[model samples]
Target: MKIRPKVTARALAVLGLGALVLSQAACASPTEPGAATTASAAGGFDYTDARGDTVTLDTVPHNIVMSEQAAAALIPYGIRPVGIWGSSTPDMSGVLAGLDVSGIESLGVSYGDVDVDKLASLEPDLVITGWYAGGYLGGLGAEDAEVSKQIEQVAPLITVSAQKSASASLDDWRGLAQTLGADVDSGTIADEKSTYDDAVSQLKSALAARPGTTAYAVAPSTQFYVAIPGEFAELIDYAEWGLDVRESPIARDSTSGSFSPVSWENAGDYTSDLLLYDTRAWTTPLAQVERDHPTVATLNAVARGHVVDWTTDATFNYASYTKQIALLTDAVKALPASE
Candidate 1:
């Protein structure tokens, strides 16, 4: 039987104390191969994950399993996970969309649907998930409490927090990659970072030239819904980088990254200079919105040809973020200035 670590009252205290204690825990475990060496390159490794849990192993993990988003960020960093879970299909617009995942086994599409028998066969030494709420999110264990227990039977786990802005979450991914022996100074990484910086600059310039331009993000299926900028990670990053992402009123208890459902007749209520149609869902595209919904067609943004595709499926990494920034910049530049 695989033995789990005993969590003391001190470890529980760490979580209650928040980020300061978490940072200290990280400090306690040096990532370098040769320090005072409780865990070394040849021996083992220890890391304080986003949840303030210290996950230690007898040896550094080679076979790993990951959530889809974690796979997106870590794959480019040269850490190919053995298995991935929680994506319905290869998201064509996602950051990892074009990546060749032929070698990686699929655990299943959604969070609670992993093939535990298949998962066991992989013999994963580590399982990486995204942190949300009081537990890990976006993997075999997240949506099901029983699944979390089952996952614990297979391997040790750690979570990279996705609770913050996209940029901050990317930083956490980078830090995790570094701990996993990625060369942060590699030429590939450097080039991607440079591209990201350039894209940000381009976006800033475009937004500056088109002052007072505002955008409303929406998904139009059978029902129309308006996105609240603060609720979505990518939208938060865009707003921070000078894009005016208009917020729709959200219920206090509503899910994060979810939009407020609205009637087609009320679509005109959230009018803005730009209409960002969510292309990630199986909804009506902006091109077809006018023919299907007369109310949406009457909006100023749509009439002026200011509608553009939006993807919340972007990977929170330099390469993916840079591409999105450039796409947004190009879309904004094509728009005519409002009178």
Candidate 2:
């Protein structure tokens, strides 16, 4: 979910993934640093998560409760969760777009607002979510010790790292889904993987064709927030794929370090050939942003109409990223070569 520069403490808990360290009260169990793994022996379920804590159960967990991001990653692999909690409404969730969530129960519609009673009613066998660098669990407010403890009492919790490279994160999710008995080898999945690979290649080719065509990704709000490429999986992927995704001139003082809030007057400080605007964060039309923040029009990209909608909260699955990569590739191809 997009993080607002000004939001409630509860909302901040979810958005502060990069910088918010897990509180002792928020952790139900101790964590050790290790590579994530999934193993089953004698029909017992054992999965070591990003935090290196292994959760064991007598049987594979079928009744699962997941954070929105986790549900998006697993649902494509045919592993649907029984319930989900998210930072935004399901209909508005960019990560959950194109995925069917018709019957699943929504534990919460806002960040860190899970219905503990409803979550417990599901009698979930496990609770899975995305883990951030600072031990933060997606959708669970780390600052809400009582809620975290209550949720912990309901089921075993495991996490897949959200901070990893997009491709690596997708692999981790696939491994988790396989462990949960998903048909990862199904034709549908194979086809999507092929499509994703093609999309990646297309993106690389587009970048190669437009060498030095710089771009900056940003979310427009009351105060503009420039994306930090290193903190985001997709941005990191783009840079690695050869796109000149520019870093913000502003420092990373925000709670998450994922974005740095700057005044509109300073938005032009980091000029680029293309402006990848965060469509998920700002729902209004692009013209509205220009009208609201006159300074936005001063940027060369804005003046040249070289802006593209960037989905910052895209799902980590190949299917989701295939579309995102394709969109970015199209944007790259549309840009004029450096003067």
Candidate 3:
């Protein structure tokens, strides 16, 4: 869509969060943006986010359709939108409480089928989507045409494609917010970054933190997979910061690089100091998994109380990542000081 040149300039006029506006020269030959800017282009938005092909909104958006789990990340920063996909889980409820949108028209149906008719009815100013493929694509299956048609009709569609890549972690969600023309608070992002760096440092400081201390993660799943925390989980590993440590590379059912299903009969095969678990699987309510195996109640983590629920409310899966990191840091801090 064509944004009025004047409105575009005015939008760039918002005070300062380091949003980069394209000079006529810069716009002519697109180049990779260095970082979330130090001076914002419009409305002090956080990043330039204008790709070779741009989706520029002339002003701070008033009514928006949030169609991905990443929607979880935006609502907290006061982008309280007109419509959002709802969630059924409760552990994630902490993250969802901040949204002030109560009575606006439901802007669009979530990841599942992309109901074109319902989306068009909401009449949103713009639609922001992420991970339609991994999150909702399974259930929707081969109906790509239907999905495309429904999405196109709602508003200008911007695809974040987060699901396509296994990222370092949730920070990727910030990139999406920048693209949406909302410059999220830098202080908030900086605070989160600082907290995260500190947590990792503390974990490294505690002598008990080590690679061999044993660690693994799992989703509250049906056909479960083993979750191996990558460089991301290293925050819990004490080393450069100093504390002896050694964690074996995670070993799971099929070498699939995901959390695995463990039974008490052979659960010992997978032992560790920490067990990270989540239930973000789009299908299969984690509640169902918890109910199906009361036996898991006997696992050492559950029995001794190391087991922690990753999320209660589904909506917060991607919404409150900073808070999520802070919570994760606190949870790790609470672990018994073994060294």
- Choose the strongest candidate by TM-score: 2
Candidate 1 lDDT, 38-143, residue by residue in tens: 4444556566666666666656677898878888888878888888887664343254775666678878776577776576667777888877644546655453
Query: Per-residue lDDT for 1-339 in model 2, tens only?
Result: 111121112222333342322222112233333232343345556666776666766567788989999999988888888888996766667779999887898889877788877876677777888887666778775624567766665566778887868887888888888878788876788899888989999988889888887888887776677888887888888888887888766776745257877777887686888888888754445788789877888898889878887886784788888888888888888886544
- On TM-score, the stronger of 1 and 3 is 1
Q: Candidate 2, TM-score vs. the true structure?
A: 0.85
Output the worst ten-in-a-row residue range by lDDT, candidate 3. Answer: 3-12
For model 3, residues 78-191, the per-residue Cα lDDT tens digits are: 465555554422123333555555664443333354445555555555555443322332222232557654444345544343332222224545555555555655655556
Error of 2 at 40 (Å): 5.6
Best-to-worst order by lDDT is 2, 1, 3
Q: Looking at model 1, which ten-residue stretch has the lowest summed lDDT?
A: 18-27
**What's model 3's overall lDDT?**
0.43
Q: What Cα-based lDDT does every candidate model obtain?
A: 0.70, 0.74, 0.43
Please name the candidate that would achieve the greatest lDDT relative to the true structure: 2
* TM-score, every prediction: 0.82, 0.85, 0.58
Error of 3 at 143 (Å): 9.4
Prediction RMSDs, each to the true structure: 7.6, 8.4, 9.0
Error of 2 at 289 (Å): 2.3
